[model samples]
Target: MLLSKAGVTAMLGLATLYTLLPLTWLLLSSTKSREDLFGTNGFALGGETHLAANLSHLFAADGGVYVRWLINTVLYAGVGALLASVFGVAAGYAFDKLTFPGKERLFSLVLLGVMVPGTAMAIPLYLLAAKAGLVNTFWGVFIPGLVFPFGVYLARVFSASYVPDEVLEAARMDGASEFRTFCRIAFPMIAPGFVTIFLFQFTQIWNSFFLPLVMLSDQDLYPVNLGLYVWYSSALTQGHPEDYLLAVVGSLVAVAPLIAVFLMLQRFWKSGMTAGAVK
Candidate 1:
C-alpha cells in the first residue's frame, strides 16, 4: 500500500511540474533582458529591471502598432465568439426540438464541416474573402471565425442535456410563443451551456493565427498572436535582437486576458460538463 501510494504521488508531482514548467519559464524569461536571456540561468531574474521598459517599447513600437493589433484582436475574438455561441445554441436547439424536412441531412453536413481542418480551407477562404473585397480587413477575420463547427457540436450536446421537452411543452401550453419560450425559459435553463460555448469560442478565436495570417496583409489589422509573430520574425531576420524581450513581454501580456476569462467562467464550464454527463 505504501509503495503504491508513493508511486502515485510521484507521478502526480511529475505531471504537475511538467504542466507548470513552460509557464514558469515564460514568466522568468519575459523578465530578462536580451543579453541575460541566453547567458543567465533560465529560471533566474536578470540584472536589469527592464520589464517596464520592454512593455513601453512593445506598446510604442512602430507608431503603436501593437495597440492596433490588440484592439483588432479584441474585436475579432469578442464579436466572433458572441455570434458563434448564439448561432450555435440557436441552431442546435432548433435541430433538437423543431422538426424540419432536411434537419438530419443539414446536421450531417455540419458534422462534415467539423471533419475539415481550418488550415486546409485557409487558401479557399482567402480567395473567397478577396473576391468579396474583405481581405486585409477586420471582417475577414471576424466572419470566418463565427462559423465554428465545434461550437455547434457543443451547443447540440448542451441543448440536449439542459433543455427538456416537458418544460418546453409547459411553456408552450402557457401560451408562450416559440421565441418567447426560448428566450424566457430555455435560455435560463441553458445559461451554463451558453457560457461554456462562449468561453470555448472565445479561446478559439483568440488563439487563431493561420486564418488571420492568410487573410490580412495589413499589419494594423493583426491580432496579438500574429503581431507577436511579426516581431519574433523581425528579430530573427533584422539583427535588432532587443525586440526579443519585447516579444516575450507582449506574449505574457497577451495571455493574461485568457487566463482571467477562464478563471471567471470556470464554474459555468464545470456545470456544463456535469449537466451533459448526467443527462
Candidate 2:
C-alpha cells in the first residue's frame, strides 16, 4: 500500500511548484507597466521594463507614505513577534512543567482562543481599544498581535517535546533558582522554538489585513498590506490603473524583508525542528 519513491518525489515537486507559482507571478508582474501588466501574458517578461520607475513612484507616492507603512510594518511585526514568543514560551513552559489548579481547563481556553477566527474579534478588539483610548494608535494593532494562542500552543508542543523534566530537575538539584534555571538552561534549549514562534507571529501580523484596517484609521499606522489595499482601492475609484501597478510593486517590496528574515534565520528553525522531531 506504500507509495513509490518516484510518486512521492513527483508529489513534492508539484507542491513546490504550486507554492512558487504565485511568487513567480508577483516577481514578473512587479516589473511590468500597468498597460503591460493588464495586456501581457501573466508569466511572460514585459514589453518594456519599469521596475525602477515603479519603485520610485511607490516610495514617493502620497508624500512617502509607503516608507512610513514599511517602517510601521517592521515595528508591528518585529516587536509583536518578539513579545508573543516570550509570552508563548513562558506560558507553554509553565503549562508543561508546573502543577496548578484548573491547568487543563485553562489550556482548553487557550485552545479555544487558537480556534477563534481573528476576524470575528476585530470589532470587539476595536471596542476595547476604543474604550482604552487606543484606537487609531500604534498600540491598538500591536497589542492584539502580542497574544497569539496558536503560538502558545506551538511553544507547548516544543516544550513538551524538546525540553526534558530531567534537565530542569538537574538544574534545580544544583541549587539554581527556578528563574535562573529557566533563563540559563531552559531558554537556550528552546531558542529554536522561539525563532519558529517569532517567524509565525511576524508573518501573521505582517500580512494581517482586517484587524489593522478596523483598529487604525490613520494612514501612518498602516502595515504594508493595508497600505497597499488603500492604494488599490484608490486606483479602482479614480479609474487610474497606475496605482494598481504601484500596489503590485509595493507588494514585492514588502515581501523582501520576510525573505531576508527567512534566509538569515531559517537555519535556526531547521535545526530546532529537527531536534524537536528526533527527541
Candidate 3:
C-alpha cells in the first residue's frame, strides 16, 4: 500500500510539472527583453525585467492594433458565450421538459453536432456566412460562436438533474406562463448550470482560432489569439525578435481572463456538477 501510494504521488507530481512548466516558462519569458528571451534559459529570469516595456510595445505596436484585437476578443467571447449559454440552456430545457414533434430527432441532431468537431464545421459555416454577406464581418465570427453543442448537451443534463418537473408544474399551476415559469423558476434552479455553460463557451470562444481565421480578412477584427499568431508567424520570417516578445507577453495577458473567470465561477461550476448527482 505504501509503495502504491508513493507511485501515485510520483505520477501526480510529474503531471503537475508537465502542466505548469510551459506556463512557468511563459511567465519567466514574458519578463525578459528580446535578447534575453532567446539568450537566457527559458526557466530563468533575465538580468533586467522588461515586462512593462514589453506591455507598452504590445499595446502600442502597429498603431495600437493589439488593443483592438483584445477588445474584439472581449466582445466576441463575452457576448457570444452569454448568448450561447442562453440558447443552449433554453434548448436543453425544452428537450428535458417540453415535448413536441420531431423532438427526439432534433436532439439527435444536437448530439451529432457535439460529436462533430468545430474545425469540421468551420468551412461550412464560412460558406454560409459568405452567402449571407457576413464574411469578414464581426457577425461572421460572432454568429458562429453562439452555437455550442456541448453546452447544449451539458444544459440538458443539468436541466434534468437540477430542475424538477414538479416545481415546473407548480409554477404553471400558479398561472405562470411558460416563459415566465422558465425565467423565474427553472432558470434560477439552473443558475449553476448556466454559469457552467457560460464559462465553457467563454473559454472556447476566447481561444478560438480557425473559424476566425477563415471568416475574417481584416486585422482589425482579429482576436488576441489570432493576432498573436500573426505576430509570431511574422517574427519567424521577418527577423523581428521583438514581435516574439510581444507574442509572449500577449499570451500571458490572454490567459488572465480565463484564470479570472474560472476562479470566480469555480464554486458554481463544482456545485452544478455535484448538485444533481444525489437524490
Candidate 4:
C-alpha cells in the first residue's frame, strides 16, 4: 500500500493540474474582449485587455440588476449557511447530550435524510411551498436551505469528540440551565465544529441552482448563479457576445468571496475534521 516518491509526486502534480486548469482558463478568458474570446486560443491570455471595461458593463447592464442578484446570493447563501450551522450544531449537541424518547430512531432518520438526493425533494417542496403561498418569495428559498442533514451529522460527530462530559457535569452542578450550559460551555468547545458545518453548507448553498430555480420565479430573487445563467442563455438573442463574456466574468467574480472565506477560516479544520474522524 506504499507509494514511491516519484509516484506520489506524479499524483500530486496531476491533481493540481486538474484543479487549476479551469481556473487558469477562466482567468485567461476573462481578460479577453468579446472578439478576442473566440479569436484567441482558449488557454492563451493574448487579447485586448478589457477586464475593467467588462466589469463596468457587467454592473451597469440591465439597470444594475446584477448587483441585486449578487446581494440576493449573499443573503441566501450567507444567512442560510449560518442558520444551518446553528440549527445543525444545536441538534447534534442535543442528540449527543440530551436524553429523550425515540432519539436514536430520530437520528437514524436524519442519517437517512443525508442519503436522500435534494433533487428528489424539489417537486414535493415546490408543492408544499405553493400550498403555503410562499412561492416566488425570498423566504420560500431561504427557509428550505436552512435544513442541512449532512451538517447535523458532522456536528454530532464533532460534539461527541469536542464537548467533554466533565464540563457539562460541572455546568450542571453550578446550576446552569441546559440552554445556558450549551451556550456558555458547550458552544465554545464546539465552535470550530460549527464553523466546519457553516463552511460546508455555505459551499452547498452558494452552488445551489435547482432549488432556487424551482422556488423563485422573480428575477429580483435570483441568486448569482441563476442570474448569470439567464444572461448566458440570452447571449445570442441580444445579438451581443459580450453578454456571454459578462457571464464568464461574473462567474469569476462570484467565486472570489468563497475562496477568500476558505482561506480565512481553514484553520478551524484541525479541531473539527480531525476530531470527527477520530470519533
Candidate 5:
C-alpha cells in the first residue's frame, strides 16, 4: 500500500512537471531581451531583464493592434460563452424536465452535433455565414461560438442530476408557471452546471483559432490567438526578433486569463464534478 501510494505521488508529480514546463519556459523567456532570448539557454534567466520594455513594445507595436485583438478576443470569448451557457442550460433543462413531440429525436440530433468536429464544420459554417452576410463580421465568429453542443449535453446531464423533479412539481402545485419554476427553482439548483458550461464554453471560444481564420479577413477582427499566429509567422518570414519577442510575451499574457478564470470558478466546477461522481 505504501509503495502504491508512492507510485501515484511520483506519477502526479511527473504529470504536473510536464504540464507546467512549457509555461515555465514562456515565463522565463518573456523576461529576456531579444538578444538573450536567442543567445542563451532556454531554461535559464536572462543576464538583462526587459520585461517592462517587452510589454511596452508588445502593446505599442503597429499602432496598438494587439490591444484591438485582445478586445476582440474578450468579446468573442466573454459574450459568446455567456450566451452559449444560457442557451445551453435552457435547452438542457427543457430536455431533462419537459416532454414534447420528437424530443428524444431532437436531443439525438444534438448528440450528433457533439460528435461532429468544429474544424470539420468550419467550412460549412463559413458558407452559411457567407449566405447570411455575416462573413468577415463579428457575428460570423460570435454567433457560431454561441452554439456549443457539448455544453448543451453537459447541461442536460446536470439538470437530470442536480435538479429534483419533486421540487419542480411542488413549484407547479404552488401556482408557478413553467418559466418561473425554471427561473426560481431549477436554475438555482443547477448553478454549478451553469458555471461548468460557462467555463467550458469560455475556454473553447477564447482559444478558438480556425473558425476566425476562415471567417474573418480584416486584421482588426482577429483574436489574440490569430494575432499571435500572424506575429509568429511574420517573425519566421522576415527574421524579425522583435515580432518573435512580442509573440512569446503575448502568449504568456493570453494564458493568464484562462488560469485566472479557472482559479475563480474552480469551486463550482469541483462541485459539478462531485455531483457527477455521486450520480
Candidate 6:
C-alpha cells in the first residue's frame, strides 16, 4: 500500500510540473531582454530588467495595433458569447419543452453540424460573407462565432437537468406567458448553466484564429491571436528579434481574461456541472 501511494504521488507531482512548465517558461521569458533571452538561463530572470520597456514598445509598435487587436478580441468574445449563450439556452429550452413540427430533424442537423469540423466550414462561410458584403468587417467574425452548435448542445443538456416541467407549468398557470415564465422562473433556475455556456463560448471565440484569419484581411480588424501571428511572422523574418518577447507577453495578456473569467465564475461552473449528475 505504501509503495502504491508513493508511486501515485510521484506521478501526480510529475504531471503538475509538466503542466506548469510551459507557463513558467513564458513568464520568465517575457521578463527577459533580447540579449538576456539567449545568454541567460531559460528559467532565470535576465540581467537586464525591461518588462516595462517591452510592454511600452509593444503598445507603441505599428501605431498601437496591439491595442486595436485587443479591443477587437473583447468585442468578438463578449458579444458573440452573449448572443450564443442566450440563443443556445432559448433554443435548447424550446427543443426540450415545446413541441413543433420537424424539430427532431432540425436538431439532428444541428448535431451534424457539431460533428463537422469548424475549419471545413470556414471557406464556405467566407464565400457567403463575401456575397453578403460582410467579409473584412466585424460582422464577419461576430456572426459566425455566435452560431455555436456545441453551446446549443450544452444548453440542451443543462436544461434537461436543471429545468423541471412542473415549475414551468406552474409559472404558466399563474398567468405567465411563455416568455415571462422563461424569464421569471426558468431563467433564474438555470442561471448557473447560462454562465457555463457563456464562459465556454467566450473562451472558444477568444482563442479562435482560423475563422478570423479567413474572414478578415484588414489588420485593424484582427483579433489578438491573428495580430500576434502577424508579429510572430515578421519577427521570424526581418523585424527586431526582440518582438518575440512582445509576442509572448501579448499571448499572456490575451489569455488573462479567460483565466480571470473562469476564476470569477468557477463556483457557478461547478454547481452547474454537478446539478445534473445525481438527479
- Candidate 4 lDDT over 1-279, as tens digits, reads 356888999999999999999888888888888888888889978444487778888899899999999899899989999999999999999999999999999999999999998888888899999999999999888998899999889888878988889989998999999999999988877888888898988998889899888898899999999999888888878676778998998998898979988988887766655654664
lDDT of 4: 0.88
**How well is each residue in 146-217 modelled by candidate 5, as lDDT tens digits?**
899998899999899888889899999999999999999888778888998999899999999999999999
Question: Quick one: RMSD of model 2?
Answer: 2.1
Number of clashes in model 5? 0
lDDT of 3 by residue, 182-279 (tens): 99988877888899899989999999999999999899999999999999998999887778888999999999888998998898877766765653
10 residues in a row with least lDDT, candidate 6: 45-54
lDDT of 6 by residue, 59-149 (tens): 9988999999999999999988998999988888788888899999989987998999888999999999999999999999999988988
- How well does candidate 1 match the true structure in TM-score terms? 0.92
What lDDT is reached at residue 258 by model 2?
92
Candidate 2 residue-wise lDDT, 78-187, digit = tens = 98899999999999888888889999999999999999999999999999998999999999999998999998898888788788999999989999997898789888
Compute each candidate's TM-score over C-alphas. Answer: 0.92, 0.92, 0.95, 0.93, 0.95, 0.92
- Ranked by TM-score, the better of candidates 4 and 6 is 4
Worst 10 residues of 5 by lDDT: 44-53
lDDT of candidate 6 at residue 195, scale 0 to 100: 93
Off by over 4 Å in 1: 1-15, 271-279
Could you give candidate 1's per-residue lDDT for residues 1-279 as a string of tens digits?
999999999999999999788788888887777788878998997544577667778888889988888888888898889888888888888888889899999999889999998899899999999999999888888999889777777777767888899999998999999999888977767777788888988998899999999998888889999989988888899977877777888888888888998898998778766765676
The full ranking of all candidates by TM-score, starting with the best, is 3, 5, 4, 2, 6, 1
